[model samples]
Target: MTVATTDLDRLKSGADQLFSKKKLAGFSIPLVIIAYLVYIFFAFDVPGLYSRADMDNARTLVADSYSYKMHVTRDNRSAEVDISIEGRRNGTYPEDGSPDWVTRGEETVIDLGQGHIATFGPEIVTYTIPGYGTFRAEPGRSGVNATFPDGDLPGWINASKNRVAITTEAGRFTVTRNRTEVFRYFNGWEAFWFTLDSPYYGLSVGEVAGRAVQGEAGDIFTAFWTNSMWRHQDVAWALFETVLMAFLGTFGAGLIALPLAFLAAKNFAPLMAVRFAMRRMFDFLRGVDALIWTIILARAFGPGPLTGALAILVTDTGTFGKIFSEALENVDKAPIEGVQSTGASAIQRYRFGVIPQVVPVLISQLLYFLESNTRSATVIGAITGGGIGLLLTQAIITQQDWEKVTYFIVLIVLMVMAMDWISGILRRRLISGDGTGH
Candidate 1:
């Protein structure tokens, strides 16, 4: 009985120790997490980032994504005025005219709505705001000479000896010794379906449809398809190039990895050295990201879709090799043995036994990679200058083509979604053994 009592006391002591360790761990885990978070917060300069953020620029960028602007610029030296959409040459107004809001005579009068008027004379520009009164600037040999209302200049107007700028809800105006410019913001994409030069520019949808019924469909489509600003034809081709990159990369990787996977699998490769070499090769491939590979390949082959495809192929080959080796290792041995008993050669045994067992995994992984690669190809294309990514990069670089950027972004998203759907369907059908439609 004394021995039994001692055993119970020992069990109680052990339980108490376990509970103490558990309690300490629970408290320590939270403290460690909090400490790490505090370190990250200071290391990343969270407060500095907040101070550096420009909310006004952010607002303007967001606005530009969905809107367009009309530029009315006058060369002060020659007194020549030109009106264009977003200041693009193709979107310039015809010689015959200007918008209804602008009136031309001895002087050009621009009505900026809500009683805001800007008039450009031979060497002077005048802007009148309803409650703010009139402001004028003249470009001379020295600089832009300016006059304003009696009170202190509002914060919206910035003036210096060489330049004067006025910003209002209606529009913006800037005057310098070289030029006088006015910008008017408007909602929606400009020249989306047809440019100003197109004959079909001002047609209503119903009118366009009637024209189509009357055999003008080809002309209308040609105009839209060849739109310079939007570049519909170019965009379509870019999307195709992107898809091609993903296709070649993913399947090429799969093909290259399949055989190599056997060399890595311990069950198939009897030599430990060969298995280790193959595994390390895979590690090397997947370890250095695809972007690094793209840069290396671009140097060798020059930038193009093919180079991007090769980079993806190399990276995914390693990944596929690892996955395929694992799948091969886990495969059932019964089928392999059964095929061997039938006097099948090594290659034939693998074909009839190993392939059939892993076909589903192979197809599923291949299709998933194909889908994933489609998105990867876009980033790769940006580096290679071959696909929609090229156009996207160009738009971003322009800094004024946010609308185009938005359009390209939308196309990219749609392209990825379509690829995802296609891959999903192919995976389901192939895995279900219904690929032949029987």
Candidate 2:
């Protein structure tokens, strides 16, 4: 009875210590998390970021992604007015023709719906806003002379000695010493299928289909495929280049890493020195980012898809080597011994025994990386000046081509999705084949 009491007391003491540690851990963990969060909040300067944010520019960028703008511009020096879609020469109206909303004669009158009208005369531009009044600006050698409505100038109108800018819900107007421009926002992609020069430019879908049935299919396809404004052919080729980069990089990495993985695997390489060297090599490869690799390769190979491919290959090789080596270490030895007992050579043993065991893992990792590398290739392409990334960068650099940027982004997303789907299918097939001894 005395011994039992002693044992019970010991158990009670151990339980009390465990509970005390648990309580301490529970309290300490939360305190540490809160402290780190506080440190980050101050370090990142969240308040300063909030202050620097511009909601108006953000709103404009968002709007530009979904919509297009038509420009009605008049050269103040020459008094020549031109109406073009997005101010592109290929999108310019034929023979100085104008949209129905714009009336052209001695003066050009653009009717921006909702009681906003702009008239462009010889050397002067006038904007009439309902509930406000007429605003006029005449550009001369000195500067732009401006006049505003009767009351105080509204916040939407910015007028100065050199330029006058008016922004409203319907459109925007800007007048400078060189040019007077009116921008009208429109919904949908402008001249995406057919440019202003094409005969099918303004045709309805039904009408286009009818014309196609009448043997105009080739012409319509040609017009759309060769659209100068959108450059559909060039975009398609760029997408292909991006895919190629990912393909060459991922498979090339896998091929190069498979053999090197044997050197890195602790079980395979008998020499500790060789194993350590291989591991450090892999560390060097993966430790540096893919972007850095892209820059280095670009310097060596010049700017091209090939440089991007090499970057991906170099970066992925280290990753694959580490993963494959770990897989090799965990492999079952029974099959390898069985093959060796049958008088199999070292190479044959690996092929018949080790490879069969790890093929599923190998294929699975390769496919997953292929899908991920497709995305990486895009950024790499941008750095190397190849693939759709180049086009995306160009569009963004222009600043006014946000719609084109949106289109490129959508295409990139679709490309990645397609790669993911294909990789999934390929992975399934490969795994099933391995299971069936194929």
Q: Write the per-residue lDDT of candidate 2 for residues 1-438, one digit (tens) a residue.
A: 999999999999999999999999999999999999999999999879877998877786898888889999999999888899988888899656888999997888999999899999986789999988899888889899888877788898888899899999989999999999999999989889998888888899999999999999999999999999999999999999999999999999999999999999999999999999999999999999798898888889999899999999999999999999999999999989998999999999988889988888988999999999999999888888999999999999887788899999999999999999999999998898666343
Compute each candidate's TM-score over C-alphas.
0.91, 0.90
Off by over 4 Å in 1: 1-13, 54-56, 340-347, 435-438
lDDT of each: 0.92, 0.92
Model 2 misplaced stretches (Cα beyond 4 Å): 2-6, 136-149, 341-346
